[model samples]
Target: MRGPDPWAAPPPPAPGGATGLGGAGSGPGAGRPVSWGREILAGAVVMAAVAAAVGPVLGLLWERLAPRVRLLVGGDALYLENPESQQAIAGDGTFLLLGLGVGLAAGVGVFLLRRRSGVAETAGLALGAGLGAVLAWRLGELLEPDRDEIRELARRLGDGAVIDAPLELNALGALIGPAFGALLAHFLCMALWGPRDPVRRPPVFPRWG
Candidate 1:
């Protein structure tokens, strides 16, 4: 055999390539883990914040669209101008309709922006809808005439006086409108055209004699 060569290059790697840890094909990002909880929490917070921002606008709309109830101040007591008037019920109906429309719009917007809807988004929408509705309720009340101020005005106007009352929401149950509408829209979209993974199957062949 020839004498060993001190400067000979190392042998080439195997054809199958490296198979052990730290191999040539290995990479840091190959199996990195994901923190889904954090992702969900962050996503929920962002969605809720965005939804809540619409409260002021909703309040303004409610104030404009809700029917006003007329009051007749008499002998330190107030009474409805028309006992048969449906203005009170109509006020609740207006709020409900407005809430439903807003919630549906929100749901469609969210779905369009994030086609991959998940639990985080759904929870956020429901929570945000309730919060926004509450905010709108309070804001709408504030925008209208104050009850105390009205009472004072009634005192000045004296008995047999008629004045328009502040816009108010009487049916507590109507608050559910936004949440119901949002969920409805979301489920409808999901049922109609949501994405699904393709199923894979082996091909079949018929035998011939």
Candidate 2:
């Protein structure tokens, strides 16, 4: 005769049950993430991209606003050179504004994408600022390689002459613009949207006699 049914109903789902097929959520993030390094790197890249794109525009703005004389007088050519004083003022103002604007935009973008601010956002803001500053510095260097020539021209030409295409980068802009911009963006985001929730701490109890 056949033995009794030892198999009963279904077997229990072992220990931790069945794992997912693929390595979903295998990488850095999701509820207490650990992708700080990666996020920082990505932020740097983003800043670099923004700087590169904006550099050309900054140069263009400087050129447009740079003061110039329409006509060359009898001896004006003797001291004709690019606009120095005006260029300095205009370029500095423009750089600061643009840097701040870019940072603010970046902050908005990050805020929209993420549910809350965290290490990634903070890192991105700080590192991105540094990168932007470096880029602004480089833009001036790369775009204006004939500084000596311009200086020489200025020395030879007479006063009142003008250089139609003058270009320069204000040192202060590269130094302070990015940092200020990043700070502003961070402040705005935090003030308006608030930062991510911090890790909760355990409650402490008092000792009893």
Candidate 3:
């Protein structure tokens, strides 16, 4: 025999023997129970990263579209009140939508990757949204209003006139964005991938045992 005929099909794997692919351990789906902690951590980290990246840009846009007062200061320059408040309101509203979109995408991804929805993933989505919103709000806090305009309004109105819109996160937005995002994501996941699998416990008594 020429070295067992090179390139010839090897002997068929013995029944129940290691199939040269996997026997007791080794395969794509082979793994321990899913690590919920890891999943939550990963999701939170990703959401935070995205929020951090967008916070400054959102803050700038919000500031530009900031609300204004209807009256004039001393009959001269426009006297705007609560630029901070206006900016926060606008930012919060705008970013809430953004956060929702992100959540939807995330939820869809989780459903597809896992081939089903589960409580762990639902929690993960909520956790991620919360963390992301917090991070974005924190970053947006760095924005400032037009100091020149503030000083001018103050000088003309003899102090305590113009309401300065301080730089900060929109409180309502921060609170609602994460909640809405997580819920939306959960809904999307359920709509797309169906509900989670019900747990199967061992037979009550003895079946064939």
Clashes of each: 0, 5, 2
What is the alpha-carbon lDDT of model 3 when measured against the actual structure? 0.53
Identify the runs in model 1 with alpha carbons over 4 angstroms from their true place: 1-34, 202-209
- Per-residue lDDT, model 2, residue 171, is 55
Query: For residues 76-168, could you state the per-residue lDDT of candidate 2 as single tens digits?
Result: 243323334354466666666666665566556555655355565566565666565666556655655364676566556656655533455
Ordered by TM-score, highest first, the candidates read: 1, 2, 3
RMSD of 1: 10.6
Which clashing pairs does model 2 show?
78-156, 78-157, 78-158, 79-157, 79-158
Off by over 4 Å in 2: 1-87, 148-161, 194-209
Against the unseen true structure, what C-alpha lDDT does each candidate score? Answer: 0.77, 0.53, 0.53
What's the residue-level lDDT of 130 in candidate 3? 64
Arranged by lDDT with the best first, the candidates are: 1, 2, 3
lDDT per residue, candidate 3, 68-140, as tens digits?
Answer: 3333244445455534444535656666666555555555555566554456556555665666566555555
Worst lDDT window (10 residues) for model 1? 200-209
Taking all chains together, the TM-score of candidate 1 against the true structure is 0.75
Q: Judged by lDDT against the true structure, how good is candidate 2?
A: 0.53
